[model samples]
Target: MKRILIINPFGIGDVLFTTPVIRALKENLPDSFICYWTNERVRYLLEHNPQIDKIFGLSRGDIKKICSKSRLRGFGALCGLLRNLRKEGFDIAIDFSLDHRYGLISRLIGIKKRIGFDYKNRGRFLTDKIRIDGYADRHVVEYNLDLLGLLNLTPPASRNLELIVSDEEKEKARELLFKAGIYERDLKIGIAPGAGASWGRDAVLKHWPPKNFAYLADKLIEEFNSKIVILGDAIEKSIAEEINGAMAHKAIDLTGATDLRELAAIISCLDILVANDGGPLHMAVALGIKTVSIFGPVDPVVYGPYPVSPKHIVLKKDLSCRPCYKKFKTPVCLRDKECIKSITISDVFDAVRRLL
Candidate 1:
């Protein structure tokens, strides 16, 4: 049986974008062994996927943490990881990292066929590559599926995002919701007021004002009697609290309360998710839940909900400088992110109402 390794050391949204590729690989090559290489934080997202036979997790933070103590030990750790991969005897490697490091590692490990995108000539070690300036004009999933042409494979008709949530996780999520005073009859609407950690300190640029979220939540409660539940990492607890503080109605704050798997489970229980462009937005799409996502610098066409439908509503400005985030970079904004800030609560509320 042929062994294949897929390399993608990105955040949740970027990593999730590659799911269609994984599904296509397993369907076309049922007997082949498929392994994934990702960061430790998102390992939970892939652990339950039956299409993936094994997973290797090593983050840059892991090496940096070791190096801070001893450079020699850090070197040894990297070498040890390489040794494990070399022993795997992988015949093919599909690299989605857009970096030369993974391609070089695949070659050093004796992989014959290395395929990836040649972004800005970074795929020098790749045996086969598609040259591109950046993710524009088409969705990222389509770009990922295009890589399959080198292997003489065609994408499946169904290109939905795949996320496998276990039965136990679903039960745990339901229990948590029950404890939060949410029941089966409640019209549950989840809101993520903070942008995800992918943007780090600059995440604020992607955020629609917290006051807007507060107003929208209150409006939803008044109109639909919706139970507002806040979702985010622990670091974003303050932002969630700010939204709750501004709103006359109260919301259950679950920031940093659940792990990644539980987060997915909680999202699955929601009737609708209103969030900024980030991981949770994509998670809701994968779970087949409706989403009304806000996009600012990033182009929704390139990174928005896959298989766009009426079920998913995207809110974005049509300014010329709106989609400044292109080619994997976001230029400094002179307008102070008016692209996202200009979006009013009424706009989002109307979109959510239409979806509901």
Candidate 2:
């Protein structure tokens, strides 16, 4: 079978954004089998994609895994993977990863046609190197899709988020919600408090404060008759718990409790999700949930919420430093996150009122 390999090697949000390119490739080349390479943690995001023939997860999960013997094993695995692809005589190798590793590997494997961006440290290896033209000042999904222009492919001008929720996943979410005493009739709201990096804390401040979120939960319970749910990783559980503790009504804290798949499933059922501009926000959008994401420091124009369906919102502050982080890193700020802090609890509550 003719084959194509797409290397993303990035975050959950980036992987979600790349799904459109995968879809476009499949639509254009229906006969060529396509595969993806990404981190193990993000594998669930692409599960059940009709266009993907397979998904390979890399080994680097945490800091220790990178330092252990697993590193050597992973390198060997990567080589073996490349060799196996060579044996298949793959027709094309596309490095969607914004890094040199995949580009160099694509070159090493000697695919018939290697494709990548004309960017720093990796342009020489690709047979097709497309330059990124004035595309950074927009949502990442659009930026990723722009790469398809390299192949003369014009995808439908639509924002789409892809994910597969099986019966098993739905059942699991149902049981979890049932166990949490959340009934179908209760208005369900989801909140994500963690961001990708602490540098993006400006975005966090733009978010409704923990106490403010707590107050909103209280209002939702009293006025809207809503039940709240908080989502995050282990690191953000403490924050979720703190918010839950302060609330007048009880909320199910799923932070650190659900894996990526289960998290997606559970979020799919929510009436709405509130989050900072980050992975969970993207995930909620993919699931077709009404999500309100707060943005500060970083440019929302480049990473704003674009619900694949019709129900999502992004709240951004107007400031000169709105997008100071050019490369997704923390900026050396003169003011300590004033851009985000300027956004108040009232702003988020008003949005929730509108969305809910």
Candidate 3:
């Protein structure tokens, strides 16, 4: 195919997971023009990807403006987006996310070859459906690469994720940290205190408590003299405040200030990153920074630290109900979300100490 479109319109971590396929496609078909479709918010992450030639992003703010209070407006806005997408003239379309919306978009865009998984009843819209075998147990990167099987391409053995951050961005990160009182001799540890952007309270399922994070930061500061920096998007600014507020020695909050490249640059300078199962954790791992990953409702086997990386550490509470979040979109809790609640500060403290 001379032109290919890869669709993954969701969270930052899921989009990052698709990079392996992007890398493989470029390696196997260097001449092809690849366009990745993702949300407007995450456009920065993929903007610099060398494997892909173009990016098709749907701006959330424009959608909000078009469909603010009307159902018909929402439908019309979607129609406009689909109509615009159809004009792109893609030779093939691959949907990493198993959403029928993406599949239907591919179909309506008139791509001759469409590929996606059979989950969520999306096979009806796809010309090819790859059956997900024991998917819940497999790493998402593997599953993303499997879609390449449709093109008669074997999955590459090396699944090391890569994101290119410019040297200028690195300088920006150092300047930011320096202004926050981080000296060259100081040990830098990053804390991701929140999950990806969510609209409602159900987002609580994926987050560790702020107090626990505060306690862990305090311990790191007291024991190692580590300079704590809380990193996240604007949505997480409150979370940073909550964590820093609870701690005796406050962390430097960089939430809402950094974009994706700057975020990667910030992560590149860190000695270690401590976070829940989310985007920053994957980014840190990809950047080759040591990380202490905290697991609660999600299964670490599928989404934890890359097993091959020796520097990464995973801290999890082995509750029977854990991996409690299904499809990671919502929770399947029995009653209380003890999976997250049961993971104590002491548990995380011990893990951080080992990393330090």
Give the clashing residue pairs of candidate 2, or none: 138-302
**Which of 2 and 3 is ahead in TM-score?**
3
User: lDDT of candidate 1?
Assistant: 0.91
Indicate the TM-score of model 3: 0.91
Question: Highest TM-score, which number?
Answer: 1
lDDT of each: 0.91, 0.75, 0.80
Error of 3 at 139 (Å): 0.9
lDDT of 3 by residue, 133-235 (tens): 3358878787878889998776665687777777888888898899999977899999998864642576667788889899889988998899999999898
Q: Once superposed on the true structure, which residue ranges of model 2 sit more than 4 Å away at CA?
A: 59-64, 69-75, 133-135, 197-208, 307-310
Ranking by TM-score: 1, 3, 2
lDDT, candidate 2, 1-356, per-residue tens: 65888887677777888887887887777887988877777877888778899887772343236537677766676666667766666678777665666677777777767777766555677788776533366677776776677677778445586777888898889889989999888889988877674334444543446776787677777878888899988777878888988987877899999888888899888999988877888888877788877777667677776633346666767887766766646566776677766677777777888886
lDDT of 1 by residue, 77-137 (tens): 8999999999999999999999998899999999999999999899999999999999898
**Model 3: per-residue Cα lDDT at residue 123:** 69
Q: What is the TM-score of each predicted model, taking all chains together?
A: 0.97, 0.90, 0.91
